[model samples]
Target: MRRITTVLLDVGGVLLLPSSEVMRAAIGHSGIDTTDEQLRRAHYAATAATDANGGPDRVEVYRRTFAKTCGVPAEFEDAVHDLLTDQFTGYTWQRVAPCAKEGLELLLAKGFRVGVVSNSVGTIEEMLATAEVCQVGGGPCAAVEVIIDSAVVGVRKPDPRIFHIALAEMGADAAETAYVGDTARADVDGARSAGLWPIHLDPYGDCPDPAGDHDHLDRFDRLCDLLTSRSGE
Candidate 1:
């Protein structure tokens, strides 16, 4: 264990884990005529790609991304648009659960600098509002120093570049900062690449193995325990 200067967080499974069932319902309702594979491709681009603030143009990003998979006629553009919008609109932030809020409050109050490293699109503010996170406009989330949305910052995770941006914003030494995220390649690999330790969460049992030393958690409910203990140790 090492002294912690900052704690970077992931949004998707770490903050407000989306309901796959709910998202599927929205995509199905969009009336996009496409095969199963194509539909899945389109859905991911719309939701995942937009998570970061600055990246590819929205329309072309998804349109070209899903084109190879869907291979739908020119009409796929309209369908992709409808399906993505519907999916984002269906995002649910279960406030009562509050895994991130609980951990964030503990980190901030303990004097550990905190920041958000989430990939989002459309708007991070909207997601935070739904999640009830108080970091809106950089005031602080129960004491978390700052939140950097990939979309807001013009970058996204898995790029390593975005993590560098987050570290710079936090003014934290890479060795002293730990990034906790759910996705293996995107979060864990990205953190490792950025020279930050990684703590991976696998609540739903989907997390994968990593190549080097790392810690994995089954549930985020005890995240506060992990961070606080890490800093003290």
Candidate 2:
């Protein structure tokens, strides 16, 4: 509720998306036909399903939900899941989200301090740079204050400690910071636990928030608007 000045984003679903080529290849191999738009919707839905399930087998949940959302027949879902399991890698998440760079630029232009806090395998910084999304310092892309990878920090999200690390690095106050991410279990809960406002990037309206607790953004432009409005308050 406080005026937002600092924004921390999750890398995977917020700025970087799964490679369309990789997803299409996997779906094709499974004999399922899907358009690029469908694949994008499926990715968000899959993450929502993972948040709903909240099980230890997150990868399996995500793949299965993705397969189902891609229109794979129930009988072929397992096969598609298997195919995804083999094909989906950390490198497969290389596509920068549409308007991601512009969104960051808009935030920075509006005087918002931006940074990344992702649950990844330590390659996110390079991946973001290669994708031309954002980086820790000045470059072709937007310059963020810090990039916190869970693997590098030895702490994962849904853990306030990880958010604290980013906050400390940015010299940001939790009340005036917003954490934007794609999952409820990890992003919303973790940010709330860390005393930061949580904003879920639910582009497809797939995530169910019965409590109506956190903010939801359907697009990057909406994020710019939300933060600008909050800062004005």
Candidate 3:
């Protein structure tokens, strides 16, 4: 394991996720009497269904599953979709990971270049800005130097080429880069395909073998420790 020079991260689930409470509240606001437990179950169900049967109609699949699991009415299906999809647009609706900003600062302080590689709706930067992650000490933080958005670039994750785009932007080699992501297929597999090391963030320990086989960190701050361990090796 060579010393890593750059760290690439996924946005949703890694840095920011729609908080469970927020999701429940939003659904409740839409006149759906859903529980936090139901939402969590549906969240995993949506992911698993998407992984099992992938298609362009993933949102529909999630909607159907979520609505069924939460006992949401057909009328509230549209509301559920809208809230989940647009949660990032409003700061109050998102849950910024406790370790994200700190981890970015740690990487920058350690002289490692950091960037965000997300499959978002072309609002990755705006979301980060809204969360005030782009600022540190009232100044712009150079910690995150690049943000490669799939929507803007017309390429999404699980495509190794997207990682190449970020590598090119950073002027770094894949051999010395590490991509941190929560999803096994999109982030871990994709990063591996691009010739970079893959680290999985398995907070819940739900991912099974192979996909969850790589180095695992329960939190982003632990990434600094992993990097240090690599440096010593």
Give lDDT: candidate 2, residue 89: 86
Could you arrange the candidates by lDDT from highest to lowest? 2, 3, 1
lDDT of 2 by residue, 7-100 (tens): 9999888898898888887777668778878888889999988888888998898998888888888877777788888889877878888668
User: Which portions of model 2 show Cα errors greater than 4 Å?
Assistant: none
The top-ranked prediction according to lDDT is: 2
Using TM-score as the measure, the top candidate is 2
Taking all chains together, each candidate's TM-score versus the true structure is 0.65, 0.96, 0.76
For all the candidates, what are their Cα RMSDs to the real structure?
Answer: 7.3, 1.3, 4.1
Q: Write the per-residue lDDT of candidate 1 for residues 75-158, one digit (tens) a residue.
A: 544664466455544244332223567776776666767777877764555666655765644454454556677777887778
RMSD of model 1 against the true structure: 7.3
Which regions of candidate 1 are displaced past 4 Å? 19-86, 89-98, 136-141, 210-213, 228-232
Clashes of 3: 0
Tell me the whole-model lDDT of each prediction, alpha carbons only: 0.62, 0.88, 0.74
